[model samples]
Target: MKKVILGLSALCMVAFTSCKEDASSKINSENVAAAAERDATSGDFPTITFEETEHDFGTIVNGTPVETKFKYKNTGNSPLVVSNIKSTCGCTVPSDWNREPLAPGESAEFTVKFNGKGKGAVTKSITLTTNTEKGSEVVKIKSFVEADPNAPAKTPAKPVIKQVQ
Candidate 1:
């Protein structure tokens, strides 16, 4: 009876040790994958992809504000966390992100507003910093404005003034 009890205790210890090793192996594998991804995207983010990399507001009237949305999804096996988002100019304001963690198969939205006050062609860029093994990303938003609200209308020339009497 004593021998049987000792053997069962040994078997239980072996099972626990095997489970611990298995768990450790899984964690190590994840770490390796993350490191590889980081190396691949050393300069720029390759794991994090945006649905629309650019937004073009062809021609907007002066004083008008145009808002655009940038959407992205997490295609990797880990959670996606956006660390920071910055706009090049003050006129371009990015809405506050919820700062929620995105799971493996999730999506998020970032809203950006462009003030079309400046004249001529304007091109602005938004920098996104994330924790998807890659470091940061840049998304561009472009707009063209005529500025002059009273530009000559395309109406046909009015009849010439009556000749002086």
Candidate 2:
């Protein structure tokens, strides 16, 4: 019984010592100071300038597809990277965008296709995720879609007339 107790005590001591805080993995003051210095000196963010942020398709026929091109330039000191492009809905698609990083003073263009399926005034927006000062940018497209002619017309009810007795 005494030997078993001694073995148990030795095992507990070994476990406690092994679990002690490791000195080599400790976060020191020097590391914090260096991190602060790096953050303070980092300021070379990219910028994007668009030729036109919005486009109007005027009047379009329903069920027709329309497309437009949006042009942009990197007008900053650093290269601009566009990580993703998303539209307001599946009816709008952004395509042919440059996948590579755009260098300063470089220009690129992308095409946005809209399936003209809605009626009346329709508006959609496209969002771009980029490595720039704003982190993200937005562009818009709008159009007036005419009513589908093939659709059933909504007729008004005829007024009832009552003859005086």
Alpha-carbon lDDT, every model? 0.82, 0.93
> Which ten-residue region of model 1 has the weakest summed lDDT?
40-49
Please report the TM-score between candidate 2 and the true structure. 0.70
Best by lDDT: 2
Clashes of each: 0, 0
Per-residue lDDT of candidate 1, residues 1-165 (tens digit) = 999999999999998777644555557777899999888766542256689999999999987889989988877766678879999989999886647777877888899999887888989999888876556788999988875667666788788887887
Show pairs that collide, candidate 1. none
Clashing pairs in 2: none
Candidate 2 per-residue C-alpha lDDT over 72-163 given as tens digits, one digit per residue, 9 for 90 to 100: 99998888998899999999999999989999999999999999989899999999999987799999999999987887899999999999
lDDT of 1 at 109: 87
lDDT of 1: 0.82
